[model samples]
Target: MKNSDQTFSLQDISPKGLERSRKLTHLISSEIGATRQQVIPFDRFMSLALYADSLGYYVAGQEIFGAKGDFVTAPESGDLFGFCIAEQCAEILDENDVAITEFGAGTGALADTIIRYFDGKISVDNFNYSIIEPSPHLSQRQKIRLSKINSRLADKIKWYTTCPSEGFFGVAIANEVFDAMPAKRFTIQRGEIKELGVAYDGENFIWEIIECSVIPELIRDQMSNYPEGYTTEHVETQGIWFEQFKKFMKRGILLVADYGYVNQDFFHLDRCDGTLRCYFKHHLNDNPFFAVGLQDITTSVNFSYLAECALSAGFAVDGFTSQAKFLIGNKLGDHIATLSVGDSVDAYRVAQEAKRLILPSQMGESFKFMACSYRLEKNMSGFADNERFRLG
Candidate 1:
């Protein structure tokens, strides 16, 4: 396994940092083609930049989440977010012989929080929990955190670098994972489709157009009506990876939560720049070329495409809603109520953190939740009232 001796921090940027970026840039160029053949699809560049074994962003031992990291996910926001998810997981686990599989378990904060919520009830003897993480560095970090916080539960959770196999039953989840996967950036030009790729200009990385597999049939049909100059993006890897995750489920629900929009809004004419961005030290901006493997590169998910893909992959679309709505509907209020009369300091701190999660200006509206079920035929509490968005 690839392990780093130290975590990469923006505060640590130096001449050595430029050299690291230079090395990864050259590695990416080599992975795609020679500099003379400069054009490579955005996804290929992204894969190398973010997931290239020990040198990629995620596996390079970078502090990529929370206050000290590049960005803060819901779990890093506080324990309340995980509590809300745990409330739902509690229900899912009430069933007999089920395991929880999580993809991209960042920092293991959510897993730790959930285990605390469940107390000593969930054990490792039967392998009731598993995490699917390809980044050796992140997996090692997660192991250390889980072991430190709750060592006994560490054995209960198994880590797999690949998707689990067929005939498994459990709750499958991915928190902000789909967006992190490589995405192909494309734009409409002169009413024809063109793909955006990366190229090296001997000195710096540049964007170039390239020929790739046509956009998926589902996306093509959706974009046919858009005007020229329209720009948007899609994650081909997301669909394929979800299909692999779907394979192991004889019956269970896959809850995917990320920031994105439906087809209409995602490919809207005015969204010409697409939703690609790089995160470094909490600074959100475009230009993945800035830090190479030092920053987080992600795109807004296309939930419309996601919904269609789940159906095509042979799963039922269980529910869809904004994160705030899902959390509110799933008993976030109830959890907050329990904290309402706690110690003044703790209560106030908890309330403030909760606000950031549900407020419109925060993660509430921008981040969306999608639940797909395989063979399971029951409604989940998270989608109880605010499930206005559902598959036809």
Candidate 2:
């Protein structure tokens, strides 16, 4: 756990933030009260904390990306990440009437960068860029930022609250998206599985144990071989989400980039505490009860489980590799080569960003890229080297 001591202080919160947090807490408490057990599953708690009507973290109109937000994503670092992704998209884009749908387009930075890079480069006549953004606040921000593009590129952008059930073909990108989806938490105690739920204590929310009978059989199969008091998360929603894609998507690839691990590492005996984490103003901690609506809660993805979902959805595992390898194979060095040595300041800036992106000690190994395709013929160039195996 990084920054375990980064606890939240009520005195440090602004009056407006404090008010919002209180309102959201009250809302959640009211819902819990309505329940017969006066408790709710952790996934339900997470959904309300992060995606409730108007008071949730995402839809509450808060600064949520880049330096001013709770955390910075790859696109916020620099255009290099987007440029590399754009190159990969260009390579996979085959049909004439194809489109690109990016799930959770945070700040629209990647969309802007990719579209700018694709201008005149993608020879497809009917190229469209669709963004499936759930938050109206973030959608407005994306519109403002993306509106600056030229008319030709600007016309290619569209927004939706959900993936179109009609489906399309081309590509789907989800960068740091699945980590935010609500996940169920459970623990093993005395050789018995128990659910970890949320309950209101009049003052704050606290953990409550429940029967594990409610957990699905699929999740139960994975909970074995763990010692007592071992806690972990399960995001069954990932598979459900994949099923939606399988039904709607005609034929295309889904690209996912997030910080996570394979099943062996994720469920290792040493990992007793699991990967659930909270972020507030760049600070990280294991506690999720503090500053409820003001903090960002996330759990590391189980890549092996994700791969299984892809396979069950009829999508072949096109590739899986570390972000470092994906970027290198996708020509990250080509972007570095464009830098002019004469301009030391500009060259240094790009070099620093590249280092942060691909260095082993930085975002490189922590983050991974997985591509699942349906009816795609060729392998993705970005994951040609060092393709991972033993995925579920």
Off by over 4 Å in 1: 1-12, 32-36, 95-98, 120-127, 211-213, 339-342, 386-392
Residue by residue across 142-253, what tens digits does model 1's lDDT show?
9888888754655678898998564668788899988988988776767777888888777677887776547766557767766776666778876686677677777888
In candidate 1, position 141 carries an lDDT of 89
Model number with the top TM-score: 2
Cand. 1 TM to true fold: 0.91
Candidate 2: Cα lDDT at 32: 92
Instruction: Report the poorest 10 consecutive residues by lDDT, candidate 2.
Output: 210-219
Q: What is the C-alpha RMSD of each candidate to the true structure, in Å?
A: 4.9, 1.9
Clash list (residue pairs), candidate 2: none
